[model samples]
Target: MFILGISALYHDSAAALIKDGEIIAAAQEERFTRKKHDLSVPINAIAYCLKEAGIDVGQLDAVAFYDNPILTMERFLDNLVFAAKTDDTDDLMKFSYDSIFGTKLWIHKELEQALGGLGKLGKLLVAEHHISHAASAFYPSPFEDAAVITMDGVGEWATTTIGYGNKEDLKILRQINYPHSIGLLYSAFTYFCGFKVNSGDYKLMGLAPYGKPVYYDLIKERLINIKPDGSYRLNLEYFDYQYGRAMTNEKFAELFGGERRYPESAITKREMDMAASAQKVVEEVLILTAKTAKEITRSKNLVMAGGVALNCVANGKLLKEKIFDNIWIQPAAGDAGGALGCAFYAYYQYYGKKRVIGISDSQKGSYLGPAFSDEEIVKFLSQNEYPYEKFESAEMFYQKISALLQDEKVIGLCQGRMEYGPRALGNRSILGNPRSESMQSQINLKIKYRESFRPFAPSVLKETVLDYFELDGESPYMLFCANVQEHLRKEFSLDSLLDASNMDMLPVVNQARSEIPAVTHVDYSARIQTVDEERNPEYYRILRQLQKDTGYAVIINTSFNVRGEPIVCTPEDAYRCFMRTGMDVLVLNHMILYKEQQPEFVEWEDWRKSYELD
Candidate 1:
């Protein structure tokens, strides 16, 4: 039976399709709508999935939604107990809620509308938010049975949940409700640090290594009350998110010493320290929760899915603690992955289908999005009159790209299927020589047009993973950070730099902390993606060719898009990004286009205004 899944009316809205328990296609609405973190109905995403599956929307045997609107409304009304009319909530509802919630609560009608009247439609099921998250975590994991943890901002009435899954059955054993959320607490710090809540939390995580966790004690004592078992309560007096749009109130600002920084403003030591403090608290809470999961469920394997699970630094620390013998994190851990999860819930839980164990995971390396064949790419380039060269073979492609990379050329790769999650992986990535000391600054300022403080990730060959980063097993999704090997790390003096009253982060960011200076962060840690031949053979072959030519099996891999833009979803999107950026080369399937060979391109508008900076 075919099943359609959807996560919508929240951030990272997406759609997933599965046939006979096999996942077929998935895509985010932001890709098609050109809106970062688009939360509308994922109509475009649903259309794409239907096309990829070679079926009409009405062909689906069943449809599942990631969240239950009734429960979510209950939680929203329950929060009124603490603060009523704090920020003119009536105005808030009238402003956007009427349009948003009215459509959302009647999602069945919307689904029917999208399905073109829903011919022979089966059950339209809705799973609770955290239940969807838990199903997403445990169902596709490599483990036969595992303890599941889902932690994010308020979802229905749950913010955090601990559960156990065995075969097709999953049960929630514990829950921490809304208003006492680890995700919201961290998001408050994210806003105070001058970043967007869901979209910019990773930027806050990236900023943590630059400063000390001096506010750790203060945050624990005043902002949140944490129990040894990992359940926590938020000090509601300090936060304003319960009532309105603002994450924090004046009390929170006064406690921190000043008002929250403006977006895209100066990054001071205060912001860095706060990021570090919040990151530390999150790591501690996650580890404590994992320990409790092991104690209660007695399961050695653990699976996780949530927005907070996107914090790779916290994930790395939890992995290091070894609270579970194994951990499998949903790559699309945010609400987007909830689409995939709810589908699994419908097939396995609602329909009582048995889950046949997989050797690794059902996610298929998350390379499940649209892919352009060489013929399609070449046809587009030829028709557009774009100057390009078509490689004769995979070997020729790999050899030439490896040489170009060694010459310090930054290449944007749009090959194979797009990655399902936030990470670029190998298919849709901008690659650079990691050994180059200035590559990070060059890419950040000249290409990405984002903060210089953010670090790049390394896509390393899985066989040689131990040669570089201190990591075991596989990290195919680029979801974990590990320290550089001791031999590769260089001795650096940061004590004097940290002591400076006016600290310039540029110097700290530029410091060569390891042999692969571009990918290494200030703390000498790298978010590593272990590449194997099985999943993405073409990328694996290119790395192998690079290893053969330069003796280094690693290269820098960042998403192939400019700041605030979603990763390129089409060949035209890829070409536009390449033309606008300072990238040296653009690889679209087998065709390669050089910057100097292309004609001068005019953007639709002043390119910077095209996207709101995240």
Candidate 2:
């Protein structure tokens, strides 16, 4: 049976198509639209999925939308009815509901029109938002049963949910409602700290180590009440997300004892302290919640998804706590993963398929998206008359790339299948030598143009993970952080960790605190991705070659894109990013193009404007 799943009208919109029990394709709308966190209906992604699967709309046995539109609409109206009487928020409530129903709920009609007016396929079987999130967490996990937790900003009605899944079914045991959301509280702080609400939450998390968690108590007492059972309730008086447009207002600033930090202005000690304090609090609450889930479910394995699950620091803490024997996090833990969620639910929950899940429920190792063939690569280069060289054999290709990385040259490595999640893995990635301490700063500031504090991750060979990190087994998703190994501690100067108790100076020494010091955080931990040959043979081959040459089992791997853009998807996108950035070599399949051989790149003032021109 063919099943098409869609999640849109929310941020990080996406589509996934599954045939039988395997994921045929999955992609986020932002990749095609060239918009970061695009919220529009995933029309482009849907088309891509169908194209990849070589199917038209009529061939699909079922279409599943991520959330129940009627249920969400009911929650929206109910919120409006209560807010109209208590908080004078009728107009804003109407706008929010209207936006969802008007744009997102009507996706079926949009698809029908796109598919040559095929109206019968428009009747999508719907799943609840949290249900989809739970499915996305558990179904692909390498476990027979697992405790599943999904926490995010308001989704239909549930902001947080905890459940347990065994084979084909998931039992949701508890939920936390809206307005009292952990995500909304963090978003409020994100806005107050001069960052975009949903997207900038990570930026705040990354900035945490630069300061102190001094405001933890103050925030707990005044803004949020953390319960013994891991649930939380926000003091609505301090937050304005329920009423007007802005996430935070003057009242929130006064409670925090400052006005909002202005963007592009120098970050101060107070701002860093606030970020650190909030992040610590978030960790504490998430840990408590995870413990609660473990106790209630009594399950040895745990799986998690939702935007909040993207916090690798909290994920690391959960691992260290040893509440569960094993944990699996959806790589696309954000809203984009809702597509996978819906697809899994449609196959298992609705159709009642006798759960014959494979080693990987997703295909190409969750690298289930578009890939350019050697011919396509050549075609694009030849079309543009781009200067390039070609390699006929895999051994020669790996040798050339390894040599470039050994020379500390940044290489754009786009090989094999594109990953389904936010992480680039080895494919659609920018690679550099991790041994150079300055490489981190150079890539962050000069190439990516993102914040220096936003650290990169190491893609280490699975067999050698324990040598460099405190982790065992595979961290394919790059979701959990582990300390640099004890043996390597001296090399990283764990012995001479400088005393910079003054919060203001923390950012200065962040780079000095850990071994694998480039990927390591101030806390001496790294969110690792362990590459296995069974799942990704080509990527494994590359890492093996690098290890034989450099005596290190790891290399720096970050998504191939500049700031304010989605991860590079197409050959054209890869070429543009490579030419514009400090990336020295561009390897699109077998064709290798040097930056100096290419024509000067003219970056579009607006990517959308550039697309329109094409």
Candidate 3:
């Protein structure tokens, strides 16, 4: 049976296709639309999934939406009614009425329209938001039975859920509903710290290691009341999300001794402290939640999904605590992943299909998106009059690229299928030599055109993971941070360390903390992606070749796009990004292009204005 799953109308809208209980294709709408976190119905992504599946909409046996629109509308109504009691209801009521009566109430009609007149479409299924998240975590995981947890901003009424999945069935034992969300609590600080809420939460996470968590007590006392069992309630007086458009109210700013930081402003010690405090609270909640999940389910394994699960620092702490014998996180743990979860939920729970466990996972390394053939790439290159060269074989291609990387030359490596998650992985990555002291600054400033404080990730060979990082298992999705092995770290002078300020740490960040300086963060932790031959043989082979030449098995890896742009989707997109950036090499499958050999790119003004800053 063929099933199509969709998550839309919120950020990271996406579509997924499943055939006979196997995920065939999945992609976020942003990828095709070239809009960061595009929230429109995933029309282009759905088309891509159908094309990848070699089936039309008529071939689908079921269509599963990630959440129940009616339930979501009910929650919105509840919040609006509460707002009426405490605050001015004019604008809030108008927005809520328009949202529910205008759009949410007509989701089925919208789906029919999106599906191009749903005449041939089969059964339409709707799963609860958190249930969809739970299914996405447990179904694709290698565990037969595991404790499951999902946490995010308000999803219908539920913001967090704890459950257990056994074989083909799953059960939600408990939940924390909207207006008392850990996700929203963190996002509040994200907003106050000069970052966009849903998207900039990670930036807050990245900034945490720089400051002391002195405000943790203040947050616990004033903002949220977290319990020992991980259940919590927010002190609504300090937050405005329930009644107003803003996340935090005047009381919140007063408690924090300031107003919200304006976006793109200079970093301050207060922002850093708030970030660190928020991060500490988040980690504490996660750990408590995991412990409760283990206690209730008595499961040896744990599976996690939802946007909060994407916090690598918190995930690393969970791994270190070892509350469960094993843990598996959905690569696309955010709302985009809800598409996959809903589809699988319909397959196993709704259709009564048997679950089939895998040795690793059923996500195919999350490389379940479009891949262009060499012929198609060649046609585009020829049509565009772009200069390039084709390698003799895959072995020779990686060998040459590996040699180029050793020279500290940055390569825009676009090969195989695009990744289904926010992470770039090897399939859609810009790679550089991690050993170079200047590589990090160069890529961030010249190539990516992003904040200098953002750290790069390391893609290390699986066999040599322990040789470089303090991790022993797989991290295929770049979802965990492990310290560089003690032996591999370099000792820094006291003066160099003392000169690093809380507000401006670039001088200290530039100092090599480990053998691989480019990928190492200021705290010496590296967000790790361990590459195994079985999962990604081509990327692994390149790492092996680099190891053979440079005697190090790590490479700096970041998404293959400039700031605010989605990762390149096609050969044309790749070439345009290549010419726009200062990348030294462009590897499109077997074809390679050097920057010096290409003709001058003339559309700088228009191209620079194309992508809006996130």
Error of 1 at 303 (Å): 0.4
Collision count for each candidate, in order: 0, 0, 0
Candidate 2 Cα deviation (angstroms), residue 310: 0.9
CA RMSD of all predictions: 1.4, 3.1, 1.6
Which digits, one per residue and each the tens of the lDDT, describe model 1 over residues 55-80? 98668888899999888766666655
Global lDDT of model 3 = 0.89
TM-score of 2: 0.93
Q: Give each model a TM-score.
A: 0.98, 0.93, 0.97
Candidate 3 displacement at residue 376 in angstroms: 0.6
* 2 versus 3: better lDDT goes to: 3
Lowest lDDT sum, 10 consecutive residues, model 3, at 493-502
